[model samples]
Target chain A: MESKVNKYSKQFILFNSIFIFCWLVISIFPFLWTFWGSFKVKADFFSRADWWYTVSGVNTLIETGGRSTLEAYINSWIEGEFWRAARNTAIVTFSVVTISLFLGTLGAYALSRSTYKYAFWILIAALVFRAMPHITLVSGYLFPFFQLKIWGILPTTIIVLVAINQPFTLWLLYSFFKTVPKELDESALIDGASYFQAFRHIIMPVMWPGVITAGLFSLMLAYNDFTVTALLLNQQNYTMVPKINAFLGTVEHGGNYMWAVASVVSATAPLFMIVMFFQRQLISGLTTGAVKG
Target chain B: MPHKTFFWFFFPSGLAMILFIGLPIFSSFFQSLHIETEQILIEVETCDPFGCEMEVQVDQEATGLLREESPLGRFNGFGTYLDRNHLAFDDLGAGWETKTSIRNFISIVLNLPFYKSLLFTLTFCFSVTPVVVCLGFVVALSVNALAKSIKGPVIFGTILPMIVTPLIGSLVLFWMIDAQGILGATLQKILDDPNLSLKASRNLTWITLIIYGIWHNTPFAFVVFYAALQTVPQEPVEAAIIDGASRFQRVRYIVLPHVYPVATFIALICLMDNFRVFEPIIGFSAEGVAQSLSWMIYKDLRNETLMLFGSAGATSMLTILGVAILLTPVLIRTWKEFRTDR
Candidate 1:
């Protein structure tokens, strides 16, 4: 019986390890391939005659007189003016994270403290808003923004993104705020502090972890957005994601598909670093609501 | 908090939501009921041309003035909703009358842009959600059994797919799976078909997209379930083990029940996210074979000649209705939970 149990367990472990190994390959190989291929010439990367050409870089040597080249990166970044889009992405994400947290922290704190039915209704309304496909909202925004003459600018996109980020931000921070002992703020209130003062002095210090996690998510939303930014912004004001999309359109004309590949790698680098550093917070943030429920 | 205090605290976020999120739904509804103005036409007589011919030409200035006067165009009164690009009510009625069979009727209905997109969107949503849940649970279990030192790195690697921007993620996969790319070439060799391309067929495109959807979403579900698995009570698992429950039986009875609620949460989120699967379609360039409702609205608004605001708006309204329907069960459950908490 003991030998039989051991044999079954050994089989289970082997299966699990093999499954994980395959999954890891599936998860990690595409990025590695793209990153490596981004350095090679397009001919070698997409070589139909020989797939090994991608690894050997024979075509890359013929085209660029080297095993790899930075020509794609230079072409995309300088000639294509991708830096402008990266700058715009930075501005948009920074402003969005700041404004979303500002509004979300105050609103979520209030919602967490209040016992009113309206507060519950507001959350439910936000839930509905969260479910609406962002393109649907962009459809509504186009005419109005055109009418107001605010289309094709950074501030307009930032404000719209901040509003869109609000629902998720409020929910995340609200859950975070719920975990804080109410007595922390109540004690400050009893000490003759105004409600705002209580929030500022008592609640703000302990709320950083939650606020940071929410800010990371908000930053990502603003950074990763394609629909709103693509539709709302003009050519000059494009963010990175939309700009990458625009590269797809113009690639065939210039035969600069490598520029797009290079830009994709460039765009994804920061997100890779972010995940590297913030994996713990991100995992916790993901599970907070799920585990609590 | 007092009402006065609470009001001030909530005001900024409330105003933002009201202006952008709340108002858009109403604006989209109103826009859906209006179509663009018709071009004004006037008779012009050419005395020397073909013995005094009279021609009707578009009066551009008059048309511009009309458009400027009412930018929402003329009130359409559900006409946009019933048009061929949308519900295609007339086409549906005609097809119904002349139907050869139910399958033919269904095919005819699906040939319409709206129905075609709806079918893909629903298929993508429902198929991706359950698979993600199950895959995630299995991955979570596997990872949970890993040694402590390697788990963090494994998690960091796993979450990369979920964390990267969807467009870029899809593009990375798409380039690999292009006809001449490594994976595509390998697939051709394996299948022994020189001309085979995943992008060439409708069913294959759908499969590729669904596969991409599963790839993109499973990590999120995995992360959530992994965390949930960590919190699974040890007592019950140990009790089952001591009670002579086999490994599978222990997992089935103890671990499954503990993580069931988290599974539901992951499913809810996956459904909501997958229903709006637009980016992958673009990245894969699968719009020729498959389009989501979001993609339809995007196409209308991006029309090269003139923006089809009314058509886009109508589709927006319908898509919003779909979201509401998807959300109904969760909302009902939340309402019940809220009542119980009170």
Candidate 2:
């Protein structure tokens, strides 16, 4: 029995270590692979033999007298208009974050503070909207926006994005606000502050973590979104996600895909920074989003 | 809260939602009833004995007027929905009335664009979600068993998939799985067949997309379940061990049940996310192989000259309805939980 137990335990440990190791590699390697592949010339990266030469790209650089890491980055930036897309993405993300946070907070605070059934139903509506894909929402926006002649503009897309983000933001913020004591805000109201003032002073400061989390979520939803931005934004207003997608379809450098790899890497760099800085918040925010909705 | 306070607080978001979301729901339904008309210019030629004369004739000028006057054309209620790209009542009828054999009829119906996309959508959701959930639970449990010192790096690596934008994440995987890429080459080598390419066939593409889905989403489940695992009780496992429960049996009885709710949570999120599986199809260039409803909407809406808004509207409505159908059980359960809490 002791020998059998030892054998089983050893097998279990070995299995788990292998599983975790594989999981880590599967999770991390594709990204590092693509990031590394971005630097190589088209010929080198697609070469069948000595693929390590692809990542190194030094031999190819010497042979062709061109195409290095900096070359790919430069080509992707200039040819892809990386700055334009990045600027548009930044403008849209920040606006969506600020606007969604403002509205989502007030609406969520209202729902959390109220004792009415309407709050419950309203929240359910938000949840329902949240569950539907943004493409569905964009469908609804098309005709009306066209009639109003506002299609494919930054503000139009921003408003639509905020509206779509509002549902999830409201859900997250509602739950977050529920954790703050009702008495805290009410006490501020009773002392001297008006309702808005109380919210601005007491409620916002009290639920700072939730606010940040909700803000991060709004930024992410706007940033990572492909369907709405892809459809709504005109050529000049393309965001990073859609721009990267457009790169996939167009022929470049004999279909090298290095520009695509470079675009993917550039688009992903900020996300890496975000995950590193806000991993805990992101994890908790995602959990709250999952469990609450 | 005071009524005025509530009003002020909820007003802006409520207005935004109503204008953008609430109105759009009704607008989508309304738009679905109406199709847009193209300004088709027809040149009619009349040949005389002396010479030939050409005169420009405008057809469907009323439609052109209507199209110009209103963003929505004539309301043909339920017409777009039942058409070939949607419910395909005509195709169904054609299949039923024409085909003599059952197998052939079934094939005809499945070949309809609407039904093919619906099939792929359903297949994607079903195949990806459950497997990802199980794999995620395994990873979560494994990581939960690891020492504290080593777990953080493992977790950081794991979250990278979930962290990276879905489009970029899937693109990375797509590149790796290209026939000439490292993983694809290695896979071909392992099979001892140079022509063993994943991108050639529909089945292979579907499998590759599903694998990518699992790889991308499993970490989310892992994190959720890993977090849940910390709250698992120590006493029950000890009692199970004392009762001579085997390691597997102990895990089966205690650990699995402890994580059941979290697994269900992951499953719900997975199912919903997978239902609208649009990004991968585009990233993989798998539109020929896999066409999802959301992608259908994108394709329709992206018709540069003809927006196909009515068709898109109808598909969007159906997609939302599908989401509602999938979410009904979860909603009911949550409502029950809320009532119990109340």
Candidate 3:
């Protein structure tokens, strides 16, 4: 038992611990520092006098009459109109996730259950589609969209995002559906239920875990998207990622660097919470396809 | 499933893909074959103080009418693809004819915008993927040996870099490495060069972006590899240990084979993702130093006054071609596997 427990040498263990400690610092320090500095004024955050000024918030106190303030948050959310972008993001993500999962489950269920050669071909075609860089597809959309007068609307962006997300969502859900026994659905079919009926009544309840996982990924894709949103949508319909990008352009003249920082922290907060609560699901989703392969 | 059932099940997804993803490739190809119409010019006679003068002016109304009439513009057939900003066939021929040596020819090729971006994209993709795989494996192995109590928090910290928005993650690191920020100041103090800036040098910018790529992507590989490591069969490891195998030997023999498939999967994903690297360039303001294929298309479409739709379309088509080439190996492998399965 002792030999089993102490398999590695003491020196090896020491080195491993040190390496992990360094890695943790490298991984976590940037976010911690940025989160801490988001509350400070620009002068303190990017202090020329001393790095310690950031930690102590000396310049923040001098500028805002306190150790820290919500000046940047208020400035970004209200003055910069980041809330509109946040709302746009909310709408886009909700629609994309719901639509993607709806279409994906049906398609993936068919692909998984079928042994036909065309189903394999469809999956392969999806693989190719998934590999295409999204910006390339956006370039193709611009001319037609401008002609159709649908270039800058939320629905256009949602539909395009759902399309772009389908290949991945389908692939993921197909793998998950493959894991579920075919007999469960076939049994329902033998009882005279139609395919759609079996899918709705028999399969969906057991499919939530997979649906939620795929939904999470689809949500991330829509939320973190910049290329599709930036290129397809007009300024009024900008999402948070592109809106944060717009903030960078105004930073030089408006001195709104802290506002951008505050917005970034705000944008990351939800993702942080999602990670905290759904770490297991996230990990499982990432490895699902790989494990099967 | 019957054909009818399958069609009904797959209709919505197929329609979406066909309309958006499938048709766009053809649309981009068609758009790439043409350039926008030149501004319409008309001669106008004006009476000056001395004499009547003839002047040529752009007729915006006529140009607008023409654009409205035929938004596809006049066909230029493969002209846009071979232009200086794209494949640059003429420029390559010129460089080949005038070069003094191989090195000089390589420099000339890199001088072209398209090839320069291609080089950077390929360099970024190849360099970042392997480092990420290796580092991720090491981290996975190390974390797997840690006491279980701290594993959860450690994993939470590890994945933060990956799960955060790429642009935001890069911006976070960008601030910390700004000239006056903590890391930047520490480096300047250590080197005793107050004027030192990571953003100023081209090579340094490349290295910084590559480092950012590795940091952002390593966590994904780590999580996958760690999960794979968890499922590694214990019997083989126990037998090897009973046979007095060294720790290094046991790992080399037992663990590596188990994780090889996961590593390949990681590499494939890394290559695909890294090829489309764009947001970091904007976040780091490194556009002056490095650009990727996606960034090139973005620049073309984002032109302030007149969007260069044809130029962007040409680049988009070529980028799609590059993606096809990158995917060929995996596609071929899948094809072969499919055949064997049949």
Candidate 4:
């Protein structure tokens, strides 16, 4: 019986090991394809026969001074106006994440620690707001904003992005805040630590992992977004993902392998870097997002 | 600082929420009733390329006009809801006429397309959620159960899919299914027909979409389920195993029941998501057949007619009605669960 159990356990482990390896390979294939493809020249990208060569057969893709991978990277950077999108994405993400974390932590504290009459109602409202789609809300805002333009149209678009991302940011941070025991707040209170101070000190420190997870998720969301950004942003203020819209039908647009390589590289690199840098936190944060209150 | 005097802590967040999130709901309600319009100059140009000055006419473009005291307002006690409802479906196709009879809404609820979409959505929700939940649970449990040495890789490998952007995945999918794509080429060869294609048929498109949805969504579901699974009481699972329960039996009787709350939560959200499903639909072009309520809403939003507003309202109404009908039991159950627990 003991030997049989050991054999069964060993088989289970072997099965799971294979499963994990397959999962890892499939999971990372797109990112890997885009990364490698980003290094190819425009000529190499377009010729289906050239890019389609089997791995065992040697190809001249590397030998002929084709726009090597590094050249493609440089062209993608310069041509895509990626820096501008990155800057906009950064500022918007930082502002939204910061404001959301600050307000959400406090609001969550109030709901958790308060003797207020409307705490439950506030929590319910927050959840409802979280569940409401961004498009529905943006539809109403579109009309008024159309009449009142701001800062030659750029700042207005960024502000709209901030507003759209706020609910999720708040919801994510609030979830983190709720996990802090009420007793911690009471203890801080007994120690004469004011609510603000306790939140800033005790609660915030303990919830840092959750906060980082929420903050990063918010950043990922803001950065990867296409729909609202495409609608709200004008041509000059186009985000990286929405820039793909330019490729839809234009001959100069979608035909080049260089552009495809550039797009995949520009979009995926930052996310890949972030995920690699903060793998644990990203997982935990996503985990939180998956479950409900 | 005092517990009772912490109202100041709530003000900023409350004010922000009210201004941003709260205002939009109210604004959507108000905008639905307005005669909305945009001035457009129709440039009448001969087919001369870049050599002609065009005559422009300002079309009488007062649009999205609401009927004063529309009967819908009287029918529903909430005038705003009625106005919103009128605006959503008023402008659908180029020449689509309004069918305001009670029978139309009933038909919408009971029609083949509507019901089929619902069934597809429900199947998607049921199958996808369980697969995700089970995979997530099993993976997390296995990882947790493993010797400490190999656990990290298991978790890392499972989550790599979740980290990449969906846009990239969709693009990669495009390449993988396009005629010259790896799978497409392989199939063309295997079938001994040069024209054999995945995108050429509706059945194939739906299959690809279902596969894509599963592939794209599994990572998300896995992450959530895995996270929830991590929190499952180890003691109970161990006790079940000690009682000589087989792995499947343990998961069924003990693990699944314990994870029921989280599963229910995931299911409700998944239902909402599966129904909305605009991104993948737009991305994959599962063709027009992939139209969900949200896609219809998106289509309506794109309509040049003040019909956009009416269509949005109609779509929203349909979506809300659908979700409310389907989710009432779940919500009631959730309420009961929350109540009983408290």
Off by over 4 Å in 1: A1-10, A291-293, B41-57
Task: Write candidate 2's Cα lDDT for B1-342 as tens digits.
Answer: 777889989999999988888888888888899887656678889789989999887667765676788757667889999988899888899889999899999899889888899998998889889898888888887887776688777788888988667788888888778877787777777888878876678899999888888888888888888778777787777677768999879779898988887788788878887888889888888988789999999899888677898999999899989999988877787778778878
Q: Residue B183 error for model 1, in Å?
A: 1.0
Clashing pairs in 2: none
TM-score of every prediction relative to native: 0.96, 0.93, 0.96, 0.79
Q: Which regions of candidate 3 fall more than 4 Å away from where they truly are?
A: A1-7, B42-56, B339-342
User: Regarding DockQ, does 1 or 4 come out ahead?
Assistant: 1
How many Å off is the CA of B15 in candidate 2? 1.8
Task: Summing lDDT over every window of 10 consecutive residues in candidate 1 chain B, give the lowest-scoring window.
Answer: B233-242
Residue pairs clashing in model 3 are none
The DockQ-based CAPRI class assigned to model 1 is medium
Clashing pairs in 1: none
Q: Write one digit per residue (lDDT tens) for candidate 3, span A73-156.
A: 998999999999999999999999999999999999999999889999998999999999999999899999998999999999
* DockQ-based CAPRI category assigned to the predicted complex of candidate 2: medium
Residue B142 lDDT, candidate 2, scale 0-100? 86
Q: What DockQ does each prediction reach against the true complex?
A: 0.62, 0.56, 0.72, 0.41
On residues B188-210, what C-alpha lDDT tens digit does candidate 4 reach at each position?
76777877666677567666666
Interface RMSD of candidate 4, in Å, is 3.9
**For model 2, how does the per-residue alpha-carbon lDDT over A35-126 read when each residue is reduced to its tens digit?**
77777776666665545666777655785576564666787788768789999999999999999998988999999999887788888788
Top model by DockQ, which number? 3
Interface RMSD against the true structure, candidate 1: 2.5
> In angstroms, how far off is B159's CA in candidate 4?
2.0
True contacts kept of each: 0.74, 0.69, 0.72, 0.36
TM-score of 4: 0.79
